[model samples]
Target: MTAAAACDTAALTAHLVARGLTASPAGVEIHPLAGGVSNDVVAVRAPGLDAVVKQALGRLRVAEEWLADPARLDTEGRALRLAGRIAPGSAPEVFDLSDGYLVIERAPDSWVPWKQQLLEGTADPAVAGRLGSVLGAYQRATADRDDVLREFGDVTAFGQLRVDPFHRTIAARHPDLAEAIGHTVDVMAASRVCLVHGDYTPKNVLVDPDGERLWVIDWEVAHVGDPTFDPAWTIGHLLLKTVHRPAAGAGFAAAGRAFLTAFTESIAGALPIDPAQLVRQTGCLLLARVDGKSPADYLTADERPRVRDLARRLLIDPPETITDAWELLA
Candidate 1:
């Protein structure tokens, strides 16, 4: 089945029944979930079944002509399972991995995205700490593992979804910073120490209403690569939020620090990456959201220049730490 066709309720329901994931479609209800540009995500609820079905789109839902491999569904399925084992409840359980889609455990109805909370100026440091712990655990457990390398070593999907749109596209647009961006890209491509969640932003993190447990979604870009990518992406996002809402900068900064402290502690100081690397990655990510194929919808016209200016500075002369990066917004 085509990715485009999989978006329909009828097609998804039929797919579920054919896979025997659902006993019957009698009382099943499927509704499309909003947000996300790369995949068609639907929430399927039925008798004793609560799941999300996602199918990779060959072309993303963006203004630019971004095309990715539909086989990324297979990658996400494998990565989700591995992530679940590594972090234990940090990722959704994979129920089925079919030809073109995945049926996975869904977050509770009350669960909301961490991105939403951040946008509302509710930056919880504890939540950041938990996210850091899970990311550190995932990278630490999979670091240098031959089995992990063999299974997720491929960077094809990562390049298509991340490097091309964000890094490469941004490089072409910013000629002066192209050298710096190119260097960052080179370093990322050379490093293959652990599994990198290419899209490890707050938007992908689902927080339970009670704020006790959280789940990280969207693993289609997961691969065996630089460990810095995941942490940088997460920290970068916190920094982005700080820029977006300067009045609430203290909260976001606190969360950034909490995440770094917890991440470092979780890894037991074994994986020491140059702080500059993270600065560069964060800069690249910030610039990507403002000018790359997928712009940050939340950023306003007045905020775009601020992000662009900060991104360039981050690329040119990176700060000593993510905390320092937060200070730039002030």
Candidate 2:
């Protein structure tokens, strides 16, 4: 193996040994786990055993200057357990994890971050629909548990992520965009309560090897907020794909529409929410990218002038219909 890959294996084996999951290094093998912005991951292999080990770092790998929260590491485990509880196998099973190291059963297949797949036109719309259902069901199951969620009126954490950095910085940097962003700030600050995967986006999901099942990963950003928040958050990424990758934009838009139709239809009458509100939330979700602290992925990239246009439009002049807005992918 290349020296870098070998080093990754050795490092992870040492970590697993320290975690007491593996006592010896002789049988264990490691493969570098690829993807994501905030974590370092390695896949560990042994006879009749397969799992992934993830660790949190102070800075992102792609841009070593950006700092991130270690407390969010603890959130991953909480999210995994909560997801499994809501849907028996919506997430992979974890054998053991601590503040720094997390070990969980590895899905035995090559998978693409749903963002990459969507950008490539290979991601399935059915999976998007399932994602909606899974998220919706999870929210409905926890909606009434006030004891489970201590706060409903505040968004200190949300402000830290969506407001402080992403949205606020843009307005501060671009004076012309201030008025549009100001409006989004008010909408985000007025959020409702429901279980939210704060970072609900395509990059965090993996399709089962057989392509029949879908799995959502990364729960470090889970919070209790408006019920339709996750849908708006996810659909925003699909909207992003449409703007950034011309070839895959059509597929991404199709998935967003299908996912929304399925999500709203599945929860019809059962939900107390209005679809228009969700659409408004989506515009706010898009604005949060510009006005919030954790900016969308496109903001960091050098190319794609259209994404800048879309972001401005979503914030400055959002479409009246989610479907009409979704067609931007075409």
Candidate 3:
């Protein structure tokens, strides 16, 4: 199938009208949402519709020449529906999925990216806990389900967007850690446990300040694979924030604890995999952000080595649990 045209206000407006999605397409306003690199996401407002339309890009908007199948939009549409069932209101509701584009529910206009909140140092424990609960519920509910596995079994997109750009790229750059990173990749490939939100970072989450609603957006990389990847991304990102601002380390550490505690509690049993696996994944994730295709823009030149050193230590001598990983921040 041919890929759709790149998403822009004018093209999207015509697409919506052509699909008979709105009678007053003239009044339908589309504004591009910033912060994503792999797709064009826009907020749409019409006479009776308030939604977000997303179309995948084969070549991601990063400095590196990263590429993935745009058909992953179909995977996202399916994942959103399933996640909405597992953890209602935690993900965007899919409305239409076709022609290599997706239309889905939009968070309230007032809602902001959770990344913004963390960057500003709010570090609300409640928000952190809720994120843990949602992720935990999604993983626990779908763990080892054959039907889910059948639908989301593919990990090609995950490889392109995550494993390759992250694990492989970093391994090449840091050959000293190649053996350990290779094992992590092998273990992840061998797993068929649950639905992994491959991009479960703060930037993908939207929240309302009133403490009322939270939406985990961007499921384009969702796949059924290693369950540890989601929590690793979350904890890894919090660790990044801690590294970014050591002055607010205490609050960030508290949020990480709350997140991990809620995740384990939501499982309501022994952790599915060894806790050490979480640490290992977090270590790899840390290395990826600092040296992989997309380094964090927030960190200063002096801070990059700090992050690199932390990642190296984590890989060589990993902490036993996610909570223990925070001590390395010092």
lDDT tens digits, residue span 1-330, model 2: 688757766777777776777767779977776756667777888655589878776666543245667666666777688789888877888878774777888875775567767766575888888887787777767665775476333345455444555656677766787776666556545545566777778888887655567778887667766666678778877776666666776677778877877766765545455455556556655655544444565544543445556656655665776667755534
* Overall local distance difference test of candidate 3: 0.86
Residue 55 accuracy (lDDT) in model 2? 76
Weakest lDDT window of 10 consecutive positions for candidate 1: 1-10
Q: What TM-score would candidate 1 get against the native?
A: 0.96
- What overall lDDT goes with each candidate model? 0.88, 0.68, 0.86
**Positional deviation of 36 in candidate 2, in angstroms?**
1.8
Q: After superposing candidate 2 on the true structure, give the runs of residues whose Cα lies further than 4 Å from its correct spot.
A: 1-15, 18-20, 62-65, 150-162, 245-250, 268-303, 327-330
Give the per-residue lDDT digits (tens) of candidate 3, residues 1-330. Answer: 113434366677877777777885678877767748888787888877788999899998889898999999999999999999998899888878878779999887788998998888778888999998888898889888899999999898999999999999999999999999998899999888888989899999899977567998888778888888998899889989898888888899899999888988887763376676777788899999889998898988988888888888888988767787778777
Clashes of each: 0, 11, 0
Provide the lDDT at 58 for model 3: 91
The window of 10 residues in a row where model 2 has the poorest summed lDDT is: 151-160
TM-score of each: 0.96, 0.81, 0.95
